[model samples]
Target: MKTFLNKVLVAYFAMTAGLILLNEPGYAYLWAGQGGTDVYIVHSGKDKEEKSALKKALGGDFKVKFYNVDLLALADYSGKQKAIIKLEKARIVIFIKDAPHELLEGSTLNTKVIIFNSGKDALKSKVKTFYLVDKTIAPPGGNTVRASSGSELNKAEAIRNADAVVVDGALDIYKAAALVVAALL
Candidate 1:
């Protein structure tokens, strides 16, 4: 009985230690990326069209990572922290619509932020903002643009406003990617 009890205790301790080690910052990087992520897409994961569009836009050349904000919210405190670290490390972070309020509130990101249909609330935390607006409406200001087509995205006036570019949600995914890529440039 004594030997059996000792073996059980050892197994318990081993599991606990493993859990702690997995939470360490070093381990967190394994999920973030080995070569490093160029772009981090934060979305709800329900919209396949948006995902396909962003992928098509970025092509296969860049290292892109996607994080479902909804899932991140459900994770434990350490898990959320790990995600924040990954987000901060990325060169560019894109916040798709339906992003959880809690995640955005907790993050202190100092990178180029692109807000896609997420709403104006996200713009409050960002330093340099790129807003994506639909092509049907006139751009609210220099910082906004109608992402209807490649031509519209390449316009001098459109590119001149580097502070932020609001893309139209109704526009095609390919066109949206063009606007996003344009914003990246």
Candidate 2:
């Protein structure tokens, strides 16, 4: 028992040290040009379908966590503090609709945005980067809707012309998640 405990401690130390080094601020992300800042994705994970969808879109390692973001609190924040807090605590803030875009911007904050239509026009905001989900790309010989992963945006110059890009058999869940991330930008 003593020997086993000692081995566990050694393994824990090594893992912790390796992570600290790999996640250093200056290091770039393993994929994309994202910097090495810690990332925690917030999503509803509505069901097995969405969970599976996200995994297919981003990857198995991208974690999904549940969080409660109260944008109304911004009504009382009276300054740039609230938006900064939201940005700092989560990698991406996910809300279905009715999110108060006005409250999110502050005079002091340099604001940028990525908006998605998703057939919901009220979601459109005046932000800089917007992703209008105008088309639904289904799998071959299928009528279902799915979100394609960012892999398409990486190489598909004609993405704007095509309706949507479907993976193996359906829309990638993470592809929707990526869309959310894109809109939040």
**What would the TM-score be for candidate 1 when compared with the true structure?**
0.63
Which digits, one per residue and each the tens of the lDDT, describe model 2 over residues 1-185? 99999999999999999878877766536423544222232223233343344445545444434322353443565443554455444343332222333334332212332222233223222332233242442222212223444454453334333333343334443465464444343
Write candidate 1's Cα lDDT for 108-165 as tens digits.
5676666665554433334445655444333225445444445566665555465444
Error of 2 at 45 (Å): 12
Scanning candidate 1 in windows of ten residues, the lowest lDDT window is 133-142
Number of clashes recorded per candidate: 9, 6
lDDT of 2 at 132: 27
Per-model TM-score on C-alpha atoms: 0.63, 0.35
Best by TM-score: 1
lDDT of 1 at 71: 75
- Pick the lDDT winner: 1
Q: Candidate 1: where are CA atoms >4 Å away?
A: 1-33, 123-127, 135-142, 155-160, 166-173, 182-185
